[model samples]
Target: MFDLDLWREIFQSINKNKTRAALSGFTVAFAIMLFTILFGIANGLENTFEKFFLTTADNALTIRSGTTSKPYKGLQIGRLITYANKDLDYLKKEFGDKIQYITPKLSRTYQLKYKKRKGEYTITGVSPDHQYLEKAVIIKGRFINERDVKNKDKVIAIGRLVEKDLFVKESALGKYIDLEGVVYKVVGVFSDNGGDEQERTIYTGYTTIQRLYLATDEIGSITIGYNPNMSADQALVLVQEITAKLKSRYDVAPNDQRAVRIGNRILQEKKRLDNMTTGLGILIPIIGFGTLIAGILGISNIMIFIVKERTKEIGIRKALGASPRSIVSIILLESILITAFAGYVGLLIGVGVLEAIGSSIERYWITNPSVKPSIVYTATIVLVIAGAIAGFLPAKKASKIKPIVALRNG
Candidate 1:
């Protein structure tokens, strides 16, 4: 099993055609390297995209009422949709602590003024929990609190853009801003310096705005934040149950003409992104494995050719009382050595490249595209399997060769 002479002979054969052997080994190595690199980069890109999405309230779920599609029981299908404050109350009572944070929002565009300085702005009426839901960064003073909603305080939190336009170098905190001749205190300023700031949006307590601006006890929409441990499917089921109860209490049809609208856009988007990442991860390996198979085929073919060309030498060994199994083992060992050594070299090169380029690549969904140790270990296992497969057929053929026929060819 441990014949020194057989190993020496196998080495001698490979050393004689160093260029050919090197080329075959390199082919396998390069394929595996390329496969690892491509997949790693794809993962990095996905990471960056996910980060961008998260910065804008990753966990927020909005429920916007949409017009009914079909006329139910001869009633008009195109009725204006609305959800009342009572509906929110009902949902709050039913779900309780199952819902982490909930808020009703009413958004409208209006001209905002601080003395002579006036600008068009989007006003949002939201509860104190809206601050937690959006993770809104307050640059100055404080956000709307429970007291503001209770007292119906005409207080507002202005975006950074509004401060730049109206206040200029003046301090924004505790300053009064006019909304349609009604004065409201600027309790906070947001550091949203992008297009969100430039649009000059204002946030106020939801109940305050509902009393002042909107005449009805209805809300424009509801925002909800579910418990992190709950799956999207679980949340959806809860929401559906709440909707059913609300419909029954309101004396509305199951497929109600006045049904409340609810949606989890964040959950849907997150699921899509996850699926995409998983697909890319799986696809890259499959393609890489194909390349590895190609390299193995090349190695196998060359080994077969080596066996055929060395027929005379093999026949002489058999004539000298070398067993068939020994001949097969010698050839198989040579094939495995070539494959494993070349594969290691290739893996090192690929990993080095990833290390070099990882930091330079822009942050994506798959940040820092480096090969994991597990991945390398997996590749090593693949190399071993490929090496064995490459050697097997050639070794089998060499074992079948008779001493007489092989010696005559020589």
Candidate 2:
């Protein structure tokens, strides 16, 4: 039920003691504001983790060859180690059960020409499975298939940006683009969430690039998608196994870290993300509880002080036939009204701050810092309820005080 008289009295009291009202409101507002900013930053950190590490398939690993740093057998240090087609075949034959999809990549840069429009773009020769390893989404036509690799076809899959740059408003599918001197037909157009640079690359068959450029079986690197079902421990063991075998095959020293490098290591990265996420899970609640506790204490203390100041007023009301329940309701309602309004104001300010600073915080790995309004709304309700409860103690105590005693004290 709406109590117009009671609300009128509350507003009158608040107007009379503007300083007290402002101080109480500031306490609740600051707590909620801090709470909002803390959670928003935590969420932003999570978003950063996802965007940074999820660019490639979680189960993928990349193998790159480098010059040896240690001598083994008769080979001297600084010997350049390289991978060939036979290495891919060797892995398939030896660890076929552990491997899901595997592909070799040969990367180069070439000037692409369509009519008079020309732009330099990265060209990567990859097997069909490279599409999955790179997590490329085919927006049009199809990705490179085994037939293209086997037949060394000159068909290419261009990135979304590449298509936009060379073909303009027209679709690039089925159109022939001249790469330097060799012309290749565009069979597919794809997009990548890895951003513009990734979407600017062009993909073709590994064999085609090998035949035209290197004229050898040499590959730039090998990308493998391990079985997703493999546990982290199993993945680690598989990495060790692959590393040992590859080093042995190349006759590099066992500890020759420079000769063979394994990148991606998503399992390890994921474990770190998991740990950090768990820490955040623990952190958010602590922040909420801390803010709530501070707000409760602040509201409770102010309510006590307000009741002290209003002792003579309360006694006069009681002498004039005011009920004990009315005395408590006035204080409790005042606290709740102030708390609810301040919390909402704090939420809006926090959201505004997040929006204003979102662009500038990318360097800190915080992206899209924000809190759901509903969550803050729910928190505000909780704070109001808590404020009511906190004010109840002092209100109840004042209601029980004898009118003569309160009047004397005031």
Candidate 3:
């Protein structure tokens, strides 16, 4: 299998036509390079989309009340619509198992102080279920439980950044922090993947906020987690039913969009995922055909030309008692070597480019751009196969040429 003289002749042939080999290799390398970069960018975009969606729970939905924009049933336009504790009870009584975790949110800005280090951060009043809705991971202590909510306890769950900001190097757990004028014990410290803004806020019992701030049973918004097993269409229908029923209950106009707005994270995520799938479905074939296949064709065409250029050499070898199979093997081996090496070089260059620019492209919403090795390797194999076919056609013809005819042509 190790034929030294055969390889020596092959290398000698390549050395004699360095320019042709270089040009052929360049075509393949360019195609593979372009192919790799495009796929890498696509993968990066996918990563960004996933990261963006993961900031909130996929099954969570938020319903916020706003001012009525239209007159209905003698109620004037611009009437402020608001949620309350009674609304939460009505939903549970009506929907029951359709709703998983429901929590009323009351948000406010309060001056938080811990030993003179004061900062105005968003203080949101939420129930224990809020932890799952906002994807909060409790790093210390625990979130608000039923006992805390029922008792209207003045305990707070601070975010990681909140603890870091006020507590300095010390832990905020079990420490009392002054909120405006009232001192609330920091019962827990939590982290969120939703970034700094989310991590800067603090959470406490909604009942505590309702009693302390409003002295009433009013809420700003309601967050609901639907049953995960519900289909996307079913979830959407549930949201519509809830919205329509709420508007009717509040005597708001049916067409008024501003009075009640619901945001379904799962719906948004599904649409985005579907669009991404469709886009990739269209894009992959386009890239595969436009770049990789083009490269394979280029390699095939160049191999054909290379065989033609060596027509007289093939003839001379045949005349010197060389077998037809030997002539074909030499040409085929040269084609494979050039295709494989050039394709690999292109792969390396493409990966290097992605690595170099990956961080810089994050602003462009492309994160960790890189191609799968299997894709590049598959493309290379395709190119090598094409090269073999190209060499075979011309090499087959050259092997049949008469010595006289080859000599005359040369």
Candidate 4:
């Protein structure tokens, strides 16, 4: 259905009214371009907010023991539940493959000293897995390794703030520091951008605490990190399974929910992500279509003007035996071509602007603001439909033109 003569006529008419046609096309193009930039920035802002919520691993969970709140199976309500090294081992043995990182965690307030500098700070103990689980960034040297944990080395990793306070003008790495009466060598200098609290804590090998300062096998907690993409229901299933196993092993009653507490950081993150998704689901259509409607109306109005200008020509064609369908088809095809061309130009410019913005803001706030190809295809399809609808009324006007009246008016 290619018609060279019809297209030639259409292009000739367009060229004749270049200024007016350009104005109409620019109107449509500007509207679509605005919509694309707005949508991309909105998506980028959402992602930036999500990053603030995730200071640690994206799918992290924590287990801590608590006193019993209710009596079950004839047990006393006031008894305190406890987690030990055995619990950490059992969980790792049973669910190791399902987890990305698992670590035993214990923290105690201690007085730190180096020469004349002295301050009270939190000293945490952990295995090598703590590096990823807590988002620990070791700026110099290395974090605790497997050999350090097994050998119970008296090596420690101090936070940047701690280094500033205790070491003063010298590098803290490979230096000696005193905790109470014991001297432990600093193996690494660490920093965390999360907050001030994260930078106030120090880390040492897990076994160091048990072998030197602590006499008991009991641990403060166990933390687990898993894949973030897992559904809440699936994660809950695993959580419940772990809870049941812990309760059973520790002699706690089956129905007592208060014997232990679980903190699901992943679950919290997933809820936020879902909420953001829902917001986007409602936002895109309202704003995008609102802008598109304005452009569509402009295209419709321009097409009507074009039909009015061609009234005498249409009358002559009808007198020469042109069918009504042919006249309508010509008008519709011209409208479609104009609308489609304008929309494509808008899409190209919009995508370029989004990329420039993304590049400028990638490190500080947003990442990959515009997913270009996805929205491009969607907009292309929308432009076609919009063109059809925009042309319909004008095409009808062209079709209804009586040769006698049109000739007289001309």
What TM-score number comes out for model 1? 0.61
* Native-referenced Cα lDDT, model 3: 0.88
Clashes of 4: 0
- Model 3: weakest 10-residue lDDT segment is 265-274
For model 4, give the 10-residue run with minimal summed lDDT. 371-380
Q: Which stretches of candidate 2 lie over 4 Å from their true place?
A: 47-51, 54-60, 67-80, 84-101, 116-120, 132-137, 145-153, 178-183, 193-197, 207-218, 225-239, 264-288, 355-368, 400-410
Residue-level lDDT of model 2, residues 64-135, one tens digit each, is 989999878988999888999999999999898899999999999889899989999999999999999889
> Model 1: how far is 383 from its true place, Å?
8.0
TM-score: model 2 vs. ground truth: 0.79
Q: Runs in model 3 with CA error above 4 Å?
A: 47-61, 69-79, 89-101, 111-119, 145-154, 174-187, 193-195, 211-217, 225-239, 263-277, 352-369, 392-410
Candidate RMSDs in Å, in order, are 7.5, 4.1, 4.1, 6.8
Give the residue spans of candidate 4 off by over 4 A: 1-26, 278-410
Clashing pairs in 3: none
Taking the tens digit of each residue's C-alpha lDDT, what string does model 1 give over 1-410?
A: 67788789879978997986787677667866775787667767676656656444555677767565556565666665677777677778888877788888888888888878998888899888887777677989998898997888999998887898999999899999888878899999986523564336899988877888787778888887777667656766766876777555644468763455666666777667656767877887787777767766766677667777778888998999988888878777777777778777777888888878888766434577866656755765676676666666766777678899889986
Which segments of model 1 are wrong by more than 4 Å?
1-32, 48-59, 65-81, 169-171, 191-194, 197-199, 264-273, 280-410
Full-model lDDT for every candidate: 0.75, 0.89, 0.88, 0.79
lDDT of 1 at 141: 93
